[model samples]
Target: MTTSPAPAAPAGPDLTDEQWTTLVRARATDPQAVAKAYAARTRPAPLLSQKDTLFLVAADHPARGALRSGPDPMAMADRRSLLARMVTALDNPEVDGVLGTPDVIEELLLLGALEGKVVIGSMNRGGLDGATWTMDDRFTGYDAASIATNGLEGGKMLLRIDDRDAATAGTIEACADAVTELATHGLMAMVEPLPYHREDDGSLTLLKDTPSLARAVTIASGLGTTSAYTWLKMPSCDDPETVFGATTLPCVVLGGVPSPDPAQDLDSWGRALVQATVRGLVVGRALLYPPDGDVASAVEAAAVVLRAAHAGEDAA
Candidate 1:
């Protein structure tokens, strides 16, 4: 991969000799280390890249405290190991960009992993994984101005509303404003909408019916000041046809909690991306942190699914 131009050093007082050495060490592989030092010196890094779009895996699992997988799952809580896997994945030609929080993005920026590549920053992390607030999603990552300044290509926020819980209103209002702001800055804002409900046992869940998904999509599409820059991040539900009727906006299926049958999950997503308004897939745990340890194969398989959809669009 060709290296994109490094961001100009943040303008400020000169770096001390020790700091300069630290930066040199940071440039080796740790993008976050470099970003932190640059921040300490008040010098933000430059844009990594702005080209291509395929499957950009989301790797923000740590914040949710879901370190383990099914029975044998791990905390996956180690930043360094996470970085290593991400860096390796980013180098793959089939993969385009990454969807993650500021820490991971900055690390990629520092390691030069994002040079001449798409960089999409995750916006809402406040929901935390599996927390009571999981459905109330909030914006805690790069904002509109940050996306523009950081040279990021786009921004994404989750909008999982559980109106029964009374927090859905806030999530809706926040998403509306976020959509407008992102559009005003000419940034692509991907809104992942889910009509969710918490069981009596308190498990956050997605509604499986067509009307529920349809109503949820309608509510989401109508958010913000305009739908021009907005795109839908939907689930691969049983009724893509019914769900597809909910909006004309471009959509992409999401990889929700990994299912016991991953092949079935990918097949479902592949079908939706092909038949409906889906433009692509925004897969997370299912593709990046899979049950098996083979990330490269999983990503390649996803790309095939995406390619088939794109080819179908071309044919039509």
Candidate 2:
């Protein structure tokens, strides 16, 4: 497939080196700066608008050791560069919020880039990419109490169910516990449940078929004591309407690994957003590190998709 021409790199953050040095110094001197920043930060008025569509930039992949974006394996390995791209993506007015692990979220908080944004904490990341125990995702990150105490909007967890893998049961139980806990705190519990099959080599492969996705959705929606505050972060499937028909809970489509063709990837997301239950998008590498390497343009393109979806809804 012919790739689109790479756009010129947009101007990065000004004085980023100096600012990073200062941030490092502060982290070294006072570990309390993260809490202070969170306390002092201004939050968005409402988590979702009247249309109920949210376009969130996700930065939680690195926590799972999945940092490859498009070609470069270590593309997101650079802390400073990743933050610079994230800040650029968040600079867009149409962008709603961010979903990240504690470290990335706290760094953005310190950089003051998360002000007036809906912040969602990543809960499970123990299933390191390519690890033998990859199916055993654990809740090693932010919990309900910490997310609420930090003034975050919600917590997200990954639940990969592989019937062949006994470890999957533990992940499900842990995620259910997290969901109940977050709901008790009146915070959103965004669960990403994907069905998988364990190969003979013990490696896991996600089953992207419609039936698999629907089954996973059914299982995830029923997790926790209550489904009131539960939301789903799902992939843009070929038949989203059928897959999403399994649950009434609100969902945000995730931008999985970057597609070689960026336009085709955006088109898929746009189509999924046409489903009423699909509230918005939670994209990461695709928007932050596009094949064109233009974070701003990639973000703008995603915003355009959401806007068009909203316009269609209003016309109906």
Candidate 3:
């Protein structure tokens, strides 16, 4: 069952080599440029579009030490290449916004690539990937106050629950507090919750079963003083309807580690989008460092899936 391919991406912005150098120089010599750019940016009127679906390009993985994409171990390690790919993806009109850490977000702001786009700040990244204390995901990135002051629409946090790991408790408590703070500011508190277990070697393994995913949703939904402004950033598990049914809050499906077969990954997202609660997509390496190296094509394809899902909702 081959799905139709998405339309080829149009030519993106022609950023010159000199411009890239200038951006780097500004970052070093004029650190205030980022703040000035943010002040000058044309903020989006509302976070969501008329369809109430948001397609956000995520660039927060590198901060967590998870930089591998496809077969390359350090695919996302190059800041220039990563930012270039991100720029290309954002140039597409179908791509609505971005979710990134402070550095990445500031870079985009300086480049003027985030103007009129929904910006989501990544809140937690202390749990370095593949570390022994990976479950101790701390809020070392953006906090609610910073996000509000920076004029971002929301903030995202990672919540990985491991019964055997005592760090999970700290992560949960931190996320709950973050939710409350973001809500107090009337900002979105996006939480990505996943259940896991520690292996004998001290490595963590994600439990993708519906039951486990459902439990994570249940626990995450109840966090904070209110679920009023809370949103769930969930993975596309086997039974998305059953798993996502565990929450009534709005949800967006994340593009997990890039898959070898991009089509299969798109299919998984398409299946999950059938659920009304699955608002849209928040993808990263899959679109930024695609197997074919066509960042624009990858982003457009995901946007197509999101549009189709919304169309179905309208028909219903």
Per-residue lDDT tens digits of candidate 2, residues 135-227? 779888899999989899999999999999777889999999999999999999999999998889776678989999999999999999999
Selected candidate, larger TM-score, 1 vs 3: 3
Model 3, backbone clash pairs (residues 3+ apart or across chains), number:
0
Q: Model 1: residues >4 Å from true position, as ranges?
A: 1-53
Q: After superposition, how far is residue 11 of candidate 1 from its true place, in Å?
A: 42
Q: What ranges in model 2 sit over 4 Å off?
A: 1-15
Q: Give the per-residue lDDT of model 3 (tens digit) for 1-316.
A: 9976443322333457987898989989998898788778888887888788889999999999998877677777878788888899999987789999999999888888998999999999999988867788999999999999989999999999999987789899999999999999999999999999888877778899999999999999999999999999999988988998888889999999878889999999999987978889999988887777878888999989899878977776
Model 2 root-mean-square deviation: 3.7
Model 2: lowest-lDDT 10 consecutive positions: 6-15
Please give the lDDT score for candidate 1: 0.70
Provide the lDDT at 275 for model 2.
Answer: 88
TM-score computed on alpha carbons, candidate 2: 0.94
Model 1: per-residue Cα lDDT over 6-87, one tens digit each: 3321121232455445545776756556445323322213222121234667776665556654333452554554565676
Residues forming the 10-long window of minimal summed lDDT in candidate 1: 43-52
